[model samples]
Structures are given as C-alpha cells and as structure tokens.
Target chain A: MTLIETILSVGFVAQALRVTVPYALAALGGTLAERAGVVSLALEGMLLFGAFTATLGSALGGPALGALCGIVGGLLVAAVYELIVVRWRADQVVCAIAINLLVLGLTRTLLVLVWGSASSSPRVPGLGSTGTWAFVAAAAVLALALSELVRRTPWGLRLRAAGERPDALASLGVDVERVRWGAVLASGALAGLGGAWLALDVGGFSDAMSSGRGYIALAAVVSGKWRPLGATAACLLFGVAGALELNLQAEATSLPRELVQMLPYVVTLIAVSSVARGARAPSALGQPLG
Target chain B: MSWDRGDSGASASSSHGGAWTALYVTLVALLVALLAASLLVIAFDESPARVFALVVAHTLGEPYGAGQALFRATTLVFTGLSVALAHRAGLFNVGAEGQLVAGSFACAALGAALPAGTPAVLALPAVLLAAAAAGGAVGAIPGVLRARFGAHEVITTIMLNFVVSGAVLFVARTWLFAPETIHTRAVVPGATIPALGLGGSAVSWAAVLALACALGVTWLLTRSRFGFELRAVGQNPDAARAGGVNVGRMTVIAMAAAGALAGLAGSGTVLGYKHYFEKGLGADAGFTGIAVALLARGNPLAVLPAALLFALLAEGGLAAGARVPREIVDVMLAVIVIVLAVAAAETRRVRASAGDGA
Candidate 1:
C-alpha cells in the first residue's frame, strides 16, 4: 500500500483514538486540579492504582465493576493527598511526588500479593469493542462538560476564584479549601478512569504500564493553556504522533524504532517550550493555601 | 506568591529553635511512616514487629549488611546532594535520572575506550570527570531553556529525561552495543575503584568520595561567594538580581553543579560497582534522591544521615523480600516524605505567624 493509504487506514484511526483517550482524560483531570490551584502530579500514581484495581475487580466481578473500583482506588490516594496538601498545606509538588512514589510501590507490592507476580497481573475480562466505544464517547462528553463547568458554571467561577484569589473567595464566605478538595478528588477520579481505560483495553495490568503518560498529560495541560478543549486537542495531536509511529513500525520503515518511540515525547518537549511564553498558569499554582 | 511569605520567616527562625524542631518533626514523621507500613505487613499475615526486627538485623546488625547499606548510601548521597544543591539555588532538579544516565554512559564509554594499562589514579579521575562533564552538559539544556525562555524547570527537566533515555538507548544500540548483550563493554580494571576490604562486601572507596563531595558541597554553600549568590537567588531572585548577583548565571551554574553531582552518582555506580553501562542500572536512584533531599530539608550535611536511612530501607527490603514484598519500603519512604512535608509546612506556618506578631 502507498504511504498515504496506509496512514489513512481505519485501523490507524481506531488506534489513534484509543491512544488519545487516556491522554485526553488525564490532561483534563490535570487541568481541573491545576485550575483549582493544586498541582496534580499524583496523576501517575492514580493511574497505576486505577489500572491495578480495575484489573483485580474485573477478575473478581465484571468490567463495569472494575471501572468503579478504579475510581475508588484513585479516591483513596486522593484523600491522602488532600489531607497532606490541603489541610496541612504541605508543598504541593513534594506531596505529589511522594504520592507517585507511594502508589508505584504500593501497587507493585499488591500485585505480587494478589497475582503472585510483581510485573503484571493475569488477563481478565475487558470492556468489549462496544463498551470501549462507549468509554470513548463518555470521555468526549466529559471533556465537553468539563469545559462548560470551568467556563460557564457558577461552580466553575468559584473554583477559578479559589485558584486565583483564595483570600477573596474566603472573605466572601465561600470555602476555598472545600472547592479545592472537590477539584482534587474529581481530578483523581478522572485520572483513574484514564488508567482504567488502559487496563481494560489490554485486559491486564503491567508494571509502570502508564509509563510517562501522566507527565505527557501534564505537558498537554501546559500546551493547551489549562483549558479542557485545548488540552483534548493537544492529546489528539500526541495521539496522532503515536499512531504515526505505529504505522512506521508496521511498514518496516528504515527509521529506527527507538527514534520513533521518542517522537511523542520529543514533540511534547518542543511544543511545551514553544508555547511556554503564552501558557499562563493559575495565579496560585503550587502555592500552599493559607 | 503569598505562599512564599512564610518561607523567609521560617528560615530566619529556624536558626534559633529550628534544629530541634526539625529533628522532632522528622522523628515523628518516621514513626508515622513505620506505623503505616506496619499496617501493610499486617495485611500480609506477617507480624510487623518481627518483620521490623528482622529487617533491622539483616540491614544494620551484620558487618556485610552494614557494608551493603553503606554502599547503597554512597550512591544516594550523590543524588541527594544533587537535589539539595539545586534546591538551595531555587531550582528543582527532577532530571537527576537523565543526568545520572548520561554520566554513567560517559563513564562506561571512557573507561572502556581508555588504553587498557593506564594507571589507576589517572584512569579513575579521567572517567569521573568525563561523566560529570557529560551530565552537566545534559543538565544545562533545561537550565538554558529556563533562563532564556522563562520555561518551567520541572516540565523541561521531565521532558529531557525521556529525551536522554531515548538518546542513550539509541547510542548504546548503534555505537556501544556489546555483542550479544544489551549492556555496553565492561570497563578496564584500572578504571574501576577498588572495593574497600569491608567484610568482603561490595563496599568501595566510592563511599569516601561521596563523603568528600558532601563536605565539598557543605563548604561551597556555606563559605563561598558563589554559594552566597546562589542562596540569595533561591531566597529571592528579584532581590538577588537587584543586588547585582547575576541570577541567570547562577541558575545555569547551580543546575550544572546539580547535574555533575548526579553524574558522579551514575559513574560511581558504574566504575565502583557495575563496571559497565547496563540498561536500567541506577534508574530509580534519582527519584530516591528526591526523598533523601526532602528528608534532609535541603541541608547538605543532613543528606548523609537521610541517605543512610533510605539505604537501610533498601537493604532491608531486599533481606525481607522473602517474607514481604520489597515495594513496601518504597511506600514507607513516600509516607515519610508526605508526613515530613506536612510537618515542615506546619513549622513554616507557625514561624510566619510569629514573625507577623513580632
């Protein structure tokens, strides 16, 4: 087949959509948390927890139940993060880093205990093709809803206020802490869902399976300037790059596989640098709330 | 911006009653982390107290175990110092992993390529210096970007990590690939740092090098003119710039210094232990350095003890792997960091309030 024809194949499009789903969801989640003035570096940890729990739950119950379990797992970690970061006002970046490490270790240990392996879990029932499509649809809806929530809704205004001017929100009798807590929890849930998609698509969990997608999502957050739709577009751009890599690999092209594998990250680095000047973060990003 | 209002105050008061408070907070956090870790042990049907006793005995009680712990601490000290130095200069060096990779690769390449019969003294220092230079070059990429473009160091550093990892893999496969093996060729004997005779353990003189580096960093930060400017930039870049301390130059220098330290960590692991460039070697040491630095609260001297504590956990984790999953130690480390961060925040809040009252 010609190169153009190969690139335009339906299989490539499906694969690109699948790759885009996790990045889009996670980036949106990061946007939510950061928009509320909290750094969400724990997206990586949350993704792992979600993937592990989803796999376990699918093995025990069903795919739907597994997804729910994923959210719960993420919430558990988020609760600890909120306690440390929000209540005690710890360094957000430090707490996020700790959470990532904790989740990585915790999940690996749990995998060994439950599945008798430290690297991966047994294959479980996954979301079938139809269910996968449903998930994609759900993600799209989530992006739209989140954009509206951040831009139009009263809650969105309050959330932005919490991030931008917490003191002002506090003086007006709105609990900035509570708003931030909600945003953080919501971010965890979304990141967990992203992770669930990863496991459910593969029907199992692998060590560091999320790899650096969480960081990529963070990059998308920056490149998209912390807007939901913009972040989604950035994720799709990354997804296209990922799809192109797969196509190149399949075509047995002369380009080295390692270089192809590096495409998405290299693109992200370049995009982030170029856009760094224009991407303004929340006013209180990384700040401990008083 | 208001969040940092508490930092200056806390730093000022820390001089008076700060040491004790910091120690107390660290102790409490360590206890809390241990307790939380014990709960996980209980879930595994293991007695936490017994497991703790075994871990302590296996890691610190025996000579060989002590040597192993010290060996691990040797590497942690370098990476920890890398993070601490950067932190003092108001830069978070999250790319230590990449820097370490570059350094080790350079060390392995130089050590292998050198004339086989070179003198130990000449070969050793040459390999180490090359490693540091390579690491510093890699680190300066993000530093220059941040200084010139106002890009966030955290994001740039993280992105560079992937870039470095990929670049290293590509280079290894194309140029340095050892026939039939994933790792590069082993280093010459003259280049390898001889292991100190410590109960026949793998512990080497590299531990002394780590100590010397720690002392050097302590002296640099405390007594040097550059150190003062770096700290000034960290505390307040605008004020430092106004006071004629070239903030941009200091940022680049601090990041290079941080990278060089991490590079030493990588080379120390390769020349002092592995003797070759292997994929995934010393991969997580950079992240562990973050834990070490946080526990040390950016104090170069304090990094020694913090590194030792973490090294103990690492050694204990391996010893206890039969009865418990080794990752539990990681969970404990994370828990300790979280607790410490919270405690540190509280201390800052109290100090800030006191300053307000005054």
Candidate 2:
C-alpha cells in the first residue's frame, strides 16, 4: 500500500512497458495516417504482418535485414490497401478489416509453408537487453517529432488540408492522392516497426503475438484524440495496467488476476467513451479526396 | 483509407432494386470465388468432381456426421441470428464470443446450484434463462454506452470480448471448476437436454429448438412492429428518430435480444454437448457469427443455411481424408466476405451517386 512500494513493484513498470511499446508505436502510425486524412485501420493487419515478416526475415537473414524486410512487407501491404481504398474507393473500414483477415491468414499460412512451424521465433541480433528501454524511448521521441512535423511544417499543413478539404487543397495544386499515399506508406513503416518491436522484444513471433494490440492501438489513437503525445501517454497508461496485472499475479494478490488483466481494456472503453464527444478527429479523415 | 460518401440516407425512395442487385452481384462473386477455390483444390490432385462429392459424402456421410453438422449448425445458427438481428438494428455485436462465454459461465453456475430434485424440463429452461439474462446484460453495456454516450461500439465490443474471455478463463479455472478438473462441473442430468439418437453422433433437441428460435426471430424481424423500427433505425438513425422511433432504446433492446440468442447458443453447447463450461468453448463463434450474418445478408431465415454451410465446411475440412488444408476454407471464407462487403459498399455508392446526380 506504500507509495514507494507501489513505484518499486516490478509488476508496475514491466506491465506498463510491455503494454505500452506496441500500442505506442501503432498509435503513432495511426496518428500519421489519420493526420493525413486516411483512416489507416490496416494498422492491426500491418502489425501482424510486421511481426510475421520480421520473424521470417530474421530467421532467413539477421535482425537488421529482417527489420528492413518487415518495413518493405508493411509498405507493400499499405500499397495494396491504398489501391483498394484510394483507387477503387472501397469503404476504408471494410477494406481495413479485410486486410487484417488477409494478413492474419497469409502470414500464418506462409509461416507454415516456409518455417514448418506456426510459432516462428528466429534467433537474430535483437536490440541488446540494455537497449530495450532505449528503443521505447526513441520510438516515443520519433513519434512526437513526426506528429509535430505533420502539424507544424508546410508539408504537414498541406497534408492536413488535403484530409480536411480536398477541393481546396487540389485547387492549391496539391495532389491529394499522392499525399495520402505517402502518409499511408509512412503509417505502414511505423506500424511495421511496432511489429518488429513485438517480435524482437516481446516473446519472439508466436502466432498471436500481436494479440489484438493493433486494435488496442487504434483505440489508443482515438482515445488520445489522434495526437502523438496523447496517444503515447495513453499507451503508457495501458502498459502500466498490463504490467501491473502481471506483477499482481506474481504477488498472488487475492483479487482475481483476470479482473486485473481486464483493466486496460476497461480503461480503454472508459477513455474512448469519455473522450468521444469532445475528440475532434480530422474533418475529412475517412473522406477520400477526389 | 478513401472514404466514400455513400448516401447513408434512410429513404425507401431510392430504388430498392439496387440493394437486391448488390446482393445478387455479391452472390455471383461469392460463387465465382468458390468455383475458383474449388479449381485450386482440384489442381492440388483432387478431382473437382471428387471434392464436391466428398463434401457431400463427408457432410451426409452418415447419420453421425450429419447429426454433428446439424448440432454444430444449431450453435452457429443462434450466433448467426445474434449477428443478423443486431445488423438489422445497425449495431455490430462483435463480442458474441464474449457474450456467449459469459452465458456459458452463468449457465454452468445455474446448473450446478439447481436443487437436486428439479425436473429436467424446468431445469433446462431455467439454466438457459439464466444464461440469456447474463449475456443480455453484458450485451446491454455497449448498447447503453453507444446509445447514451455515442461510444463507438466497435472498440467497446472488441475490448469486451477480451475482457469476457479473460475473466471467464480465470473464474472457470479458480472458482467454478474444481482446480483439479480445470473446467466447470458437469451439468446435472436433469439440466441437460437429451440428444436425438443418431448413430454415433448425437443431435440435441437443441437443434430443433434452435431452428424454432430462428423461425421465431425471422418472424419477429419481418412481421412485427419492432422489426420495422429496427430496420428504420438501422437504415437511418436520424430518420428513424424524426419518425418518432426511440433509436437509443431500439439499439439497446436489439443488442439485448441478440445477446440472448447468443447465450442460447452457448447454453446449447454446454447443456447438450459438454455438460460443462470449458475454457475456449466459445472459440471464435462470436467473430464467425459476423461472417454468417454477412453471408446470409442479415436475413434471420437465411442464417440457418449460412450457419450450416460454415459448419459443413468446418466439419468437412477437419474430417480425415479430406486432403484440404483447413485453412484454405478460412481463406475462401475471407475472400467471400471481403468480396461481398465490397459489393455491398459499391451498390450503396452507386445508388448514392445516382441520387446526387439527380
């Protein structure tokens, strides 16, 4: 019950980071895509694909090359996603869900075919143990800068305008589609790195390694009001909840561990509901610019 | 993601034929995909002819396989009904898995604590009722939040699924099932529904019960005043409200009803098959229910056939000697679902554009 004890508890910090890393990265990706006016729901699918590809890449090559492969893989998926939503003008929500299903199966099937194992954990040069927390910090900083750039820079302003009102932006001579494409690809890369973090840092490439964190990240982005710093903080909060659950279980707390585990999700629900009315998403976020 | 400003207006003035046509195109697209998938299977050394034959053979192979499929379909039918019903009200109940799990947990508790001398007939219904109530309550949470607070049901529903599963796993492991067994205790014989004797495979009377429930729901959806309100709300909430429908209440009630149906499905699994609530019993029934609703085009009557189709594919895929990697079925299903969703969205877009043109 002591404040010092609570802060020092291994469960608190570990659970917080364990939950925060993937979510923070994914939400950052979501912030980028949404900021550019595209609803990048493919974040979840991309996350899974990232995990699968990174593991596969590391297994075949090494960690660095594998991470590169994951980036490529993710961008490739984003391109396909762009084709569907951008070219065909498909409903982004459905397209994103389909993409999730597609990646989920494709990765699992491909893994089976190639690695002959559903759970593919590759031995590769991961971020050294000492650098684990460093990676998380760097990710948070990068996301903050990227989000700030999207808001402050001329390029960021144009991208925001393209998402807000395409006719106005197009009249200004900006190709809305091109801007969205770049944003989406960037989104994929960030989401892919998030996946890489999961594979390399979180237990190596289990089938359900992402475990719906992609969706959770989406919630984080929404709950964070689609701001980089807000989303990161939200991710950290959920991470703390998750890490706390583990430690609570370790301490053999009388409160059911399951209920404790439910905290993050419950928090997400409460946060989303509370903020939904006040949150101002980009006006034209899901609206495809002509 | 490109957002299409598909006229989501609630007007029957737009040609209804467009919706039908969209459905038609979707069906054709699905059939084409199936044909292509079948050919792919054939290319893998199994004759296309033999594949269909085996599907038929394994599905209707014996009284047992057929019975099992029917039983499986019964559970799916209710879950599918859960999804379809909610869709009619424009609420996506993706947490059917959670609702179902929660219902099963409640049902197990109800069955275990029932008085020793209770009659089988009364006991069964009582257990089911308890399940429905519990599941319905859980379903109502998101419904209430969405109605009252405008919370996105998608996020809440997905999160709820995890919450339910995690909670159920812990409770089942620690409290309900003796830790020794690691699952809930068996339902008392009086609480169990007797299965129809089909050689080898046991078909629960629950199948007939589920079929009846499906018919009743279909009737309620198509013939009742509530159905009209539900459709109006789903098709256009703003319009429904202007027309005097309490859209919020309708959403909440619809979710509760859908949850009840899903709860019944979960109870069927426990009361008829396992007689105990086990971890992972609901599996992906909740999510699969979405595909079922879509495949059935949100028709309560059609959910039966769609559920049966999925059950057949699932059972057939796993049957020894099928020669197909079961995941292929998942791929086929996914393809069908995406294509259908696209077709639906496209039809909506085309009509909207035409209206805008006018």
Candidate 3:
C-alpha cells in the first residue's frame, strides 16, 4: 500500500493507538501537574517505580492487585518528592533530577536483590489479552474528563490560580500548598497507571524500560500548552511518529535501524522547538514557593 | 556561579552566605547523605561503617587506588567545569556526553590522519583544536536552537544527545572503525599524551591540562567583562537585557564554551589512555559532571574538590561492592544532591528571617 493509504488504514490506526498509550497517560498526568505550577520532572522516575512494583505485585498476585501496587509505588515516589520540593521548598528542577537518578539506581539495585538479575525480571501474570486497548480507552476518558473538570470545577479554578499566581490563592484564604500536593499526587497516580500498563503489556519489567517516555510526555505537556486535551493530542502525534517508524522498519526499504530508532526524538525536537512562539508555560512552574 | 534563575526575588537561595554558606551546605549534605546511605546498608544487612572504611581505603589509602581516583577525577574536572560554566549563565547543558563523543571522534580521526612520526609540536595543537572545534560546534547547536528558535535548552540539549550519538554511531560503523572493532585506528605516537608514570596507570599530562583549564575558567568567569555579563544573564536575563546585555548571544556562547570544556575531557581517554576513539569511552563522565558542578555550587574553582570527592566515592564504591552493592553509592550521591538543594532553600530562609545576610 502507499504511505498515505497505510496511514489511513485500520491496522495502522490500531498500531498508533497502542504506541500512544504510555505517552498519552503520562502527558495527561503531566498537564494536571504543570497546570498546578509543578514542573513534574519526577514523572520518569514514577513510571519506572510503578512498573517495577507492578511486576513485583503481579508475581505475588495478579493484574488487579498489581495495578494497586503500581500506584502505591508511584505515590511512594511522590511522597519523597513532596518532602523535598514542596515541604522544604527546594529548587524543583534540581530536586527532580536528583530524584530521577536515585530511582534509576534504586530500581536497578532492587532488581538485583529481588530477582537476581539487573536487567529484567522473570515473567509474571499481568494484563493479558485485552492489551494496551484498555489504557488507550482509559487515557482518552481521563483526558476529556480532565478538560471538562478544569473548565467547570471550583477545584480546577483554584489549581489554575495556584499555577498562575499562588499569591492570589493565598490572599483568598485557599491553602495553595494543599492544592499543589493534591495536584502532584494526582499526577503521580496517573503516571503510575501508565507504568502498570507498560509492565502488563510486556508481562515483566526491564531496566530503564520507561526509557524517556516521561520526558516525551513533558514535551507533550509543553507543546500542548498544559491543557489535558491538547497534551493528549500531542501525544497522539508522537504515537504517529512511532507507528511510522515501526512500519518503515517492517518494510522492504534498506533504511538504517539506528536512524529509524531516532525518528521519534527528531520529530519531538522539531515539534517542540518550532512552535515556541505561542507556547506559554505556567508562571510559577519550577519555582519554589515562599 | 549563581543558581538564582529568575526566582522573582522570592528565594535567592544560592546567594545567601557566599563561600561560608557553600562550605556549610556541602558538609551538611555529606553528613546527611552518609547517614541515609548507612540506613540503606543496614536494611540490606550490611555494615555501613565497614563499607565506608573500605571505600576510603580503596580510593585514598594506596598509591594505585589514588592514581585511579585521580585518573577518574581528570575527566570529571573538565566536565564539571564545563557544566559549571554554562550553569553560571543559567543554562543546563545536558549533552556533554554527545559533545565529548564529537570531540573524541574528531580528535581520533585527525590524529590518525596525521603524517607518520610527525613532530609533537605541530601535531598536538592541531589535534587538540580539532577536538575543541568539533565539540564546540555540537554544543552550539542547542544554544543556537534555544537562542533563535526559543527551544528549552534542557530538552534540546537532551534530544541533541541521542541525535549526535546516532549520527556518530552511523559514521563510525560505516567508515571510521579500524577493523571490526568499535574504536578508530590508534593515533600516531607523536600525538599521544605523556603518561605521568604513576605506577603504569593511565593518568597523564591531561591532569595538568585539567588544572590549567580550571584556573583559566576561574579567571575567565571572575575577571573578564564576559564573565560579568554572563553572570548578569544568569542572575536575571530580563534585567541583563534591560542593562543592554545580549542575553541570547551570551546564552549561545556560554553553551558553546561549556561544550568545548566537556569535549576537551576526551583528551584523557583518547590521547592519554586508549590512543583511539572508542564507543562509550567517556562513561558517565558527562552525567557525573552535573553532580560535580552542583556540588561545586557552579563555582569554577570549587569543581576541583567536588570532582575529587565524587571520583573517590565512585572508585571506592566499586571496591566496596565486594561486600556492599555499588548502587548504594549512586543512591548516596543522589541524596547529597537533594540535601544540598534543601540546604540552599533553608539558607535563604535563614537569611530572610535574620533581617540581612546571615
């Protein structure tokens, strides 16, 4: 089939939706956090931790318990983050980088200690036949739900105020810190769901499996201008790039695999750097509140 | 060296106590990191005190270990200074790994192409300049993108890393490899850096060059008018632009300079140690620099001690890993970074409550 025809084909659309699951879920969570003025650099770490716990929990029970365990794992990371960045008021970007490194090392160590392998764990009974279709549907629902809730709810109004001007929230007797905490934790839970989906899809956990999806999700949040719907769509754009790369890899062309592997990042860079004119970030993003 | 990245004057945490505060924060962070690390070891059924002692002994107590620590610190010093310089201009250059790759590739490629048995005088400077130019060009990419296209330096630099690595990989695999190996052909003996004769270790004249660069960077950042404007840009780009400073130009120049510094770190691995450009030659040399630069509080001169400390832990931690896991050392390093950030915040709070600089 021609490239255009292939892109419009049902098979390609299904492949694209499957590829976009992690990015869509993580980006939606990121939008919520960035809208509340947190940079959410810990998304990558949370995803890794959540994936790990999901695998571990699956080994103990099944996908149902595994999902709960994954979220709790993500919340564990969020608790530490809150302590460092919010409670102690450290530089958000700095702390986020530190926390990411810590997670990378800790997860590797845990894998070695628990599974006797530093690279990957043994297979476990995880999310079986339904596959990423479940997460794809869930992410779409959450994205639209978040869009409406932010537009209509009082909590969403307070979230916007916290991001745009925490001082305004404070003047109105709203606990800005509480709102930030909630936003960060909520972001963590959603990212955790992404992680669980990832582990369940593979039926096991691998070292650095989340790779840079957390970061890609951050790009989606920025390019989407911190709106849930916009961010989800941006993630779908990345998914399109992934699907195209995969299709090209499977074709008869002699394109280099290394170059093919680089397609998504190239697309992301161009997309992010190209439209800097209209993208406005939350004012208090990455700043430590007084 | 300021960490005051447009904090809206609400928390000038990095600037409160100057040298004393930096010293206090470093020590406190070390203590906290050690205590936390010890707790981790105890939970894993290992003795923290023994692990600490073993690490120190392996890294500092013996001549060979000392040489290894200094060897590792050599690359880190270059990269630490690289990160610290850009940081002083309020940009985080996370692509040091790629920049180093470019430099080493250029350095090796040029060195191999030199005339057989060429004189060191003409050969060395030409090869070194090639390294710096290649690295600087790679580094300038993110700078140019951010300056002209308004890309976030952090993201652009990271994306550039994967792009550069892939490009280099394709090039190396296609034409640059010596045979079936990952490295290029060995450079001529004239291009090799003289070893320092520390018990046959890889430590070489690059150590001396690292020190020289640090001294040069310290002077450049403090004495030059360039340094003044760069610091101004870092502290507040808006104010600096208001005061007639070219913020975008400074940002680009700062990133390029930082990339050059990181690129020069390849000298130790290529000319001094392997005599060829190997894939993954500068392992963790780029990322570890971030920790080193942060530990140095963005100060060019202070990077020396901070790099030394990290090198000891890394080398010593490997030695200690016979009984204790080496990843624990990574965890400790991360804790140090987090604690130092918290200390910066606390310092600002103390100064605020004290009615002046505390």
lDDT of 2: 0.76
Cα deviation in Å at residue B13, candidate 2? 9.6
Better of 1 and 2 by TM-score: 1
TM-score of each: 0.96, 0.89, 0.95
Off by over 4 Å in 3: A1-5, B1-4, B7-20, B356-358
Question: What tens digits encode model 2's per-residue C-alpha lDDT throughout B189-305?
Answer: 899878887765656888988899889998897799998988788877888899999999998998898888888887667888788888788686776677787777677787888
- Which candidate leads in TM-score? 1
| DockQ versus reference, model 1 | 0.64
Task: State the displacement of the C-alpha of residue A47, model 2, in Å, after optimal TM-score superposition.
Answer: 1.1
Docking class of 2: acceptable
Clashes of each: 0, 4, 0
Q: lDDT for every model?
A: 0.86, 0.76, 0.84
Q: Which ten residues in a row have the lowest lDDT in candidate 1 chain A?
A: A249-258
Alpha carbon lDDT of residue A105, candidate 1?
Answer: 91
The digit string of per-residue lDDT tens for model 3 on A1-290 reads 88899999999998898788888888887888888888877888888898999899989998877888888888888888988888898878778777888988888888877897879999998775564567778888999999998778999999988899998889999998899899889888888888887898789999888877788888888888788988888899999999999998898377877788788888888878877658888888876677
Clashing pairs in 1: none
Q: lDDT score, residue B41, model 3?
A: 78
> Model 2, stretches more than 4 Å misplaced?
A1-18, A119-125, A130-134, A166-175, A253-255, A284-290, B1-56, B320-325, B352-358
